[model samples]
Structure formats: structure tokens, C-alpha cells
Target chain A: MTRPVTSTDVARRAGVSQSAVSRAFSQGASIAPETRRKVLEAAAELNYRPNRIPAIMLSGRSRMVGVVVGGLSNPFYASTLECLATSLRAAGLQILLVHVDDALTLDSALDQLLSYRVDAVVTALAIGSQRAARMLSDLAIPVICFNSRLTGPWISTVVSNNHAAGLTAAQVFESCGVTRPAWLAGPVRNAASRARGHGFIAGVRANSARWPDGVLEMRGDDSYESGYDAIRRLLARGERPDGLFSSNDLMACGAMDALRQHGSLNCPDNVVMMGYDNIPQAGWHAYGLTSFDQQVDCLVDAATQLLDAALGPDGGPVSRTRVVDARLVTRRSTARLI
Target chain B: MTRPVTSTDVARRAGVSQSAVSRAFSQGASIAPETRRKVLEAAAELNYRPNRIPAIMLSGRSRMVGVVVGGLSNPFYASTLECLATSLRAAGLQILLVHVDDALTLDSALDQLLSYRVDAVVTALAIGSQRAARMLSDLAIPVICFNSRLTGPWISTVVSNNHAAGLTAAQVFESCGVTRPAWLAGPVRNAASRARGHGFIAGVRANSARWPDGVLEMRGDDSYESGYDAIRRLLARGERPDGLFSSNDLMACGAMDALRQHGSLNCPDNVVMMGYDNIPQAGWHAYGLTSFDQQVDCLVDAATQLLDAALGPDGGPVSRTRVVDARLVTRRSTARLI
Candidate 1:
């Protein structure tokens, strides 16, 4: 293997000091124009690119944010990552991405992020364990949980107003005269699903006296297959839901398909469907799914703002929660029956 | 802000030398068990973390692979990223992700990756310009174009045999006895889409004299809306195609919705549709679209194997291309009619 050209080699070739070679590559660093030209010429000839690792060590800043994400199959998460990446990049920061598959991997992913000494962390996954949370807090690294919340001195949260969105779904159901409404919840451990479900059930109980029976709740893994199977099992039991609220758009699409395949049921005619996270597929002519737009751009903006504040010169260990409002986008799936 | 604890602080607290503190933190470093235990205790007390930046500089290996991706709205790309991340993580490597939105941003993203001194780069986007290709080659960085191909001395490619997949689509159309067929291609610069379109056109010309009328061609941005608009325009021109081959499954779904919404045509019965990248949604009961499975796992395996070989000892600037076979997953969308 050939040895990589270093700044020292460029210094020798340019007839300048090593510091001069470094200054030529360092942005905003002072260097004479003639010396800078000489250094660049030598660098181009030797193919010597200035390395950032040692500079990062010296400055105590990597200018890299650790972004931990998973569930790419869920378009919502994928979209969230895209927004976060763009927002971070615009701020002149790079993303050191850690893709965690599950809870077990989340711990190790956090460890890897810590080893890299990321300036900050923005995670789509929830930091579930207190041990992990405490570890991050001890290091004084600012963490901003995107679309998820955790309580810690060093952790901040930016999430959608999921509870209010659920209430909006219930209001839509009531206005449509939908009785026996069902709530399709994500995993039992998912906090966002739980909050949405709680608000929906509460609204259902408070609104209609015709609703003596509580809403039917089915748990899914926030996957299309899970949603499809959940509805299939419900139908097999001869139970029909007049209205359905899903935790995400993907699951709602699956439920809609399952209902259509049942042959007797039709959307917005026999049943109304509402979903969270207004993903792109929801707008397809085939689905026209009514969903809550989590306003990913707003969420990303809030997260980045928090990141900036925490990473700024006056940055300190502070914890705060920012909730962005989610608006409901009505489509054919949730059209009024009356 | 409080100053971060350094190795000197830990060494002082542990009654050991600073080098001993580093050795204790380093894996496989020669250190006494008692000394290591003392260093750990002091480190815990001081909330100190051994920074990896300096170690990376000393070893000249970042253990990070730069992964450039875009089009997360497409499930195919999302799935590909998940597979790559999982495979790379298993090999104990981290990913420095660069999310490029377009060609202009792609150059800057590569520069960022270069400044990080990434060990290898795997890009989903085509490295189009000769200058960019030459830059990577000059740096002796092993560049692997995932699901894309580029010709350079240092560039390796791991992609599905898209042309063969196109031929398979043509065969399906022929067997279905389709008289009029159309090819929906992606962006003009996309090589994969061009290859598929070429193979499909070639196969159509070679196989059936009944196809002398030739296949209609439409261009899209590999988006759902693009496919929908392309079909709408074709229909507006009073051009009716009995068969359709889409560059991606998302566009296929869009085209399917458009046909159904037109109120005159349907899938398989009216128009047998074929798509590439059998994403999760392809199996949904709603679409049940027939598409080619790129076998993401196989592609990821090949890419990682090439990466391993390139980053291994005795590694050279070798160029090669490994093509994974893509198989057709038949569904109701392309069912044969007697």
C-alpha cells in the first residue's frame, strides 16, 4: 500500500512551515496569499487533503451530530430522517448516523455515538432506559429526541401534539355519527401511540351519550402487515368498527385494504378511517386517507433550534419540551356519511 | 461551561501515569488488571470519555464508511439503506451519511466525506462527472457505487442486473399476449432506468412480430405523482397501452391508481403492470403489484464484501463490478390472460 501524502510533505514541497500548510486548508485561518497559493499547489500535486480528525480533537468539536434512527420501512420515519439531515446540513453539520433496529441495539448505538464524541444527538427512537439516559447526562452531551420524549437534565424533546390530533380524530368520528369507533394502537411500549390512544378514548367517552360502549383497541407493530392482520382478526370475530383511528398512515392503508377485501365494507360509507402522520401515500387516489400531518418540517426546525441553543457558546445543561401542532388533512376516507 | 475531564485528571485520581490511563481505556492494550480497575473507577467519578478522534488520527483509519443516499420517499432506497446499515454495523464499522438531494449537492457531500477521511465510500447516486471520479481515485479511496455503476480505475460497483430484470418484464408482457405496451422510465440521467428501458425495448423487438408497433415510452422522476401524471397524459392523448413496465414500484402503484381512476381500465385484466424493486407495498392487498425483487440482502452482502476486500491488508486500487440477479415476484398485477 502506498503511504498517504500528509501536511508535512506539503510543507516541505511548498517551502513553508507545517503550520502554514495547515493554515492554507483551515477556513478563516490567517495565511499570506503567496504562501497559501504555494501550499495549494503542493497539496494538489501530492493529492494531500487536510484531515479534520486532529483538528476536531484540538477544538473539542467534531461539527457532527449523531442521528439515530430506525423503522425506515415506515415512510414517516424515512421522511423525518430526510428532513433532519437537510436541516442539519444547512447548519453546516454532518450526520453520524446510527441505525438501530430495536431496543437492544439502541443501547449499543448510543455507546458508539458517545465513542465518536458527537457534538449533539437527535434520535427518532426513544431513549427508554434510565441507565442510558444517565450516561448521556453525565457526559453533558445535549440530546434532542425527535417525535419522542424523555425526561433528563440534558435531554430536550420536540414532538407533535399527538394527543390533540387524537381528539381531532374523535371529533371527526362524532360529527360523522360513527358509533363503535376503534383505535389501532402501535406497540404497547411506544409512548406516542399511548398518548394518542389515551386522548382518543377520553374524547370518545366525553362526547357522545350514544357511546355507552368503549372504543375497540387493537395493537399493531406500526407495520402494514400488522394492521392488516389486526383488522382481519377483528373481522373474523364478527366485530365491525364504524370508525377506525390508526397510529400511522401505513397501518391505516393496510386496514383500509383489509376492509375492502372483506367485500361487504367500504370506506367512508360503512366505516370511516383516520390515520396519523400524513405520509405521501395517504394522498394516493386509491386511498385518499385522512391523516394528521405531524408537520415534520416544523418538528425538525424545533429540534434544530434546540440543538443550536444547546451547542452554542452559552450552551448549558437545560431540559425543555417543544410540541408542534399537528393539523388534520381531510380526504375521502374520512368523509361525512350524513 | 465546565471543562471536560481529561486523561490527566483520571490518571491523577487513579494514582497512575497518563499513558496508563490511555492503555486502560484502549482495547487489547497491555495494562494490569488492578490499574485498569482504578482507571475505570476514576473515569466513572470524573465522567470522562476517551475521545476517538485522536486515536483515529494516530491510526489513520476512521473505521467509518461514507454512505450517500437520497430519495427516501421511495421505499426501495429506504430498504436498501436499512440493509446496508445493518450489514456495516455487523462488521463493526460506522456510517457517515451524506444525504444529497441533487447533483450539485452531491459534489459538496463528497467533499465533506473526504474531509472526514472516511475509509470507503458507498454511494447510491451515480458518480456522473469525471472530475469527481478522479478526485476519489487520486485519494486512493475505494468508491463503491451501490445499485449504480461508474467507470473509474478505483471505483467498484455492486448493483442488480437491471437489464435482465427488464427482459423478464418483457417476457411477462409477451406471455400475457399484450398488444400495446408502454415503458415508464425514471429520470433521464438515471442509468438503471435507462438500462431497464433498453433491455425491455430490445426484448420486445426480438421476441414477437406482433410487437412491431413498438413500445410507448414515458419519462418520470421515479415518483408516485410522476407516474400518475405520465399515465394521465398518455390517456389524454387517447393512447391505450394494454401492458406497462415501470422503473420502480412506487410509479407502478401510481400508474395503477391512475388507470383505475380513469374509470375505463384495470390492472392485469385491462393492463398487466410490471415494476422493479418489489418493495413491501407491492405485496399489499390493495396493489398486489408484480415487480422484480432486487434481493437487497444479496446486494448489501456483495457491496460489503467488496468494501472488506478494498479496506483489507494488501488492498489495492482495484476496479470491479458485481451484479446480483433480480428475480420477478409475480402477483395479480401481471397475471396471464388466456
Candidate 2:
């Protein structure tokens, strides 16, 4: 059997350097039109398709990753996605982004991504089923869950320290001498929210007998309107909660808008509000919302390391769940009372 | 030479149905662990690997597309990206997403995407230079320029009726009988911004002899802060334009917030404000912003059709530019003076 044509063969036929032939095939590379045309002609004659990534290269480095993410509406996820894409590209890997509209379809999304033979799969969407986790392991695919982590160590995960965030919010309110505090919660089913809420209750219980009852709880669907309506309902109860700890920043902003519009509350003065996910908008002069920064870079870094180890030789696919620390940003929303 | 092993061979060897064999390789596909392990063992015995797609298959039916987008911070692009991903999946194609932080790096971004051998590319970032356009066409790859059309027919494009959108805003102000209409423009270098601004000026010229001088124009970076600061600067001049048309919804929201906080101007009654890109916040009761809906689904459909034709057998890789109409959404932000 005859040997297959290669870039070097095409280079010889085109009478150009091997690098020039590679450059002609590369999208952003700048080779003269004449040289590129000659390379293309030579490649066509030799049936030398540049796109065919070799299997040896594929097993070692397909240079592609699948990232399934939901929560595009949240700036935090959007920003985090950008950071991951940049970081992945810096390491010569391209990203395939699959936005899971619903959690039910997450399995299928992963399936589709796997068909692409990606080097790794990172999901920002919550996937909790053991069966799904096992399937991924069966395929020996490297998997990393971002932001929200699962109960099992079947998949390596890197998440923000949501428990600490909740604790910080409770402490902020207690230190400000707030008599009544409310938890403006995000999607209750969300693990991140559950962690934050759990920590908040624990911290509050530690400080005052006001424990559970003192914690007025209201739910928001991570939308501005949800938070706005929730705050309006709480305020209509005659007296407003002296302190508010929102599960996410958007909800906190909406709550703040509601307070200023209806209760004429100018945070920290009339009410103190602490939010999770210190999105850039929270820093706006109008909001000045005190919140927590998830430290996306650190999370991305952890996930990157996990991926490297999983794909490395002698890899047992060591399982791990790493929780990076989060920092509380004190802004006007939760200013301490004088 | 022997025939290559196929899924049917794997299925026959494992005593499983063809569909089951396929499912084992697919994501989101459900199969019993015992059955899956059996199929895998059989495949290992046969040395069968379904993931190694040949170069011919890679170039022809890999069914993957690359989408490089910027301005995820802008909800419009974020929403557009989601729509494209869903539509592409419906057509059995996967998406490779690249977040271009700066327009300057777009060349390299496109290069990396091409290395994946995507069937096509969709870029929302403006491509102004002739060289960039030539490079894409030189690859003999199909490209769909989303949201903004370039100067040449080398690439297919779909854009919103930005100029008409400008005209609609101009007419809205005139119908409201505003004496001084101000334009809150986005980045001057952005083609979309230029199209909208040019259309607005022309629209005003058609309605009144006072033409140019009767209108006010201020620049914004299409951010909430830019709009807020621009409005504040206009207010500090001790003058208020009766009509305001912001290039984007975020900027428009910012402008409205600034007006209410500093200028004490009630929208529609004292000053009517119109925004482009009808983001979800525009419909919220707090803003009730009147804006233009770019009809993202329609745009996606147009680009999809273009891709189909370019890849079709009878298709000449035809290159055409299509602009769809955008409808005005009238809300409280632009109430008629009564």
C-alpha cells in the first residue's frame, strides 16, 4: 500500500518551506496570496486535507473542551465562562460551549459534547445523579463541575466557598446590631444557595435566640422582578426586616430597588443588605451592594490542574472536590451602624 | 486490506441492538451498566473506536460550527449566542464558542477555531479590515457574520434593521412633538452604532427643516455607567433634551436612572426615552423601557438558511447580506405626552 500524503509532501510539491505550508493551512497565519494558492493547489493534487487531526495527537491532545453552562442571565457565570475560554485558549485548547436550557437535558448535552471527543468536560450546570456520574467515568472522560458541586466524588469539582459567604452575611448583620434579618434566597434547589442559606442560619443561630424566626425567608428565581416582588411582599408585612441577606447579587439589587422605591429605605440607613456574587453592577454608585466575590480565576485554576492530572499518564483519575475561599466585599449596602 | 469495523460489527459482537451500540457511544443515552460494559468489552476485543472520524468525514459531516462573540456583558449578544446554539443543535451541529475580549485578537480566535475544522463560523464581532474577510474566504470555509454585515460578498451576513431602527426612534420623538431630541450613541467605532446614528440623523432630516441643529448627540460605550454619566453631563449643562434615544437598552436604563435621580425628570411626561435591544430589564415595571426588539430568532433563521445553502450540493456557496426588520416595543419609558 502506498503511504498517505503529508504536509511535507505537499510542501515539496509546492516548492515551499514546511512552515510555509503549515502557515498556509493555518487561518490567522499571513502567507502571500500566491504562496497560499500554490500550497492549496499542491494540497488538493496530493489530497492532503489539513483538517484531519491524527489519532495519536487526538488521544494526547485534541485541544478541545466541552463546557456545559446554564445561568447565562447571571453576569457571574457569563464572566466566568469568558475567563475559562481565555484560560483554556491560552493552553492551546478550544472550547465547545453547550448551554443547558433545563437540567433534564444536561445528560444529553454531555452526550453530544462527548461525541466530539473533547479532552475534558466542565459543567457549570448542576448534575447530581450517580448514574450520570458513573457513565462519564465509564467513558473515562475527565469531568469537572464548576460553581455548584455534586454529592459524590465521581467527578472532580471546584466551587466557591458558599458556606463562608453565608456566614459572612450573618456576621455583617449581627455586627450592625440588626434586630430582624431576612434571607432573600435564590433558587432553593440550587446547591450553592442551599449551602449559603445553611451557613447563614447556623451563623444567625450562634448569635441570637431570634435564630429561625428572626430570619425572614423569601424566595427569588434569580431574576430582578423576583427579588423586587419578594421585597415588596416583605415590606407590606407592616415592618421591614432590619437586615437582608440575598442569595445572589441580582436579587440583592432588585431588593435594594424595591426598598428605595417603596419603603424609602437607603440601605444600611433604613435596612442593611448583603448579597452573594459581587457582580460588577453591585459596585455601581447607585447600588453599592455589599457582596461576595467567587474568585473565578482561582476556581478556573483548580479545575485546570484537575484536568491536567486526569489526562496525565499513570493517572488513576484521582477524584477531588476543592472549595476555594471567597472574600466579603463591604459596600454601602451593609455599612456598619455608628 | 480489511474493511474497517463499524457500529454494526460492534453490536453483532456484543449481541446488542445497533441502537444500543450507538447509544453506548452517545452522551445522554441510557443503557444498563452491564450492557454498556459488555459492549465496551466487545469493542475493545474488536479494536473498534467510533470517535476517530476520518479526515473526509471531518471535513464533510463532523457537524460542528465555531462562534466567536464579544460583548457578553451586553445581554443582546448573550441572548443571540444562546439562540444560535439552540438552532445549530436542532440542525445536528455542535458549537465551538470563543469569547473575544478585544477585537484585535479576533484574528487569532478565528485561527484557533479553524484548526478544529468547523463546518462554518459565525462572528458577531465587527470585521472591518479587508484582510480579515479575505482570510476567511481563502480557507474556502463558509462564514456567517451575525448582527453586522461587512463590505464584501465574500461572506454571508444577517443584520437587524439598525438604520430603520434609527428612523423609528426619530419618528417616535417627532410624533411626541419633542422640540429637542438627543441621541445617546454607543462607541463611535462600532458599525452598529454608526448605522443607528446615521439612520437617526437622516430620519430627523426628513421630518424637520431644523434638521441637524435641532438634535443633541452624546457618546456612550453602550454601558449603564456611560448612559448615566452622559445624562448627568447633559443635565449639568442646565439643559434637558425633551427626547432621548439610547443606542442600547443598558445605556437607556442608565439614562433613565440618571434622569430620575438627578434631573428629577419623569419619563414620557417630561422626557421620553427610547432604548435599543429589548432586554428583559426593559420590560420590568421599574423601567418599563420602550425599546426595539432585534428579533434574534429571525436573525438566527436567516444565518441558518445561509449555512444550508452554502453547504448544499446545488448551492454555489452563494454570498448574500440580509437585514431583518425590528419592531418597536412601547413601554412607560416612552409614554405620549398627555
By lDDT, who's the top model here?
1
Q: Please report how far candidate 1 places residue A338 from its true position, in Å.
A: 1.5
lDDT of 2 by residue, A307-336 (tens): 777767735555787889988888988775
Q: Which ten residues in a row have the lowest lDDT in candidate 1 chain B?
A: B103-112
Q: Chain B, TM-score, each prediction?
A: 0.87, 0.84
Q: Pick out the ten consecutive residues of candidate 2 chain B with the lowest summed lDDT.
A: B103-112
Off by over 4 Å in 2: A1-6, A13-49, A55-61, A103-108, A151-154, A209-213, A264-266, A336-338, B1-9, B13-52, B55-59, B103-108, B151-154, B209-212, B266-268, B336-338
Model 2 achieves a DockQ score of 0.41
Error of 1 at B33 (Å): 11
Q: After superposition, how far is residue B268 of candidate 2 from its true place, in Å?
A: 4.1
Q: What are the candidates' interface root-mean-square deviations?
A: 1.6, 3.8
How do the residues B1-338 of candidate 2 rate in per-residue lDDT, one tens digit apiece?
24657788999999999778878876578999988998888886775657645533535556678888777777777777778888888776778887788632255565555446677787666665666776666556678886554534447888889999999888888878777889999886678878898898888878776455757989998888999999999999987788998889999888887888874777878998899889877876667899999888898899888888876774544578888899899998777663
What would you estimate as the lDDT of candidate 1?
0.85
What does the lDDT read for residue B21 in candidate 2? 84
Candidate 2 has a TM-score of: 0.86
Instruction: State the weakest 10-residue window (summed lDDT) of model 2 chain A.
Output: A51-60
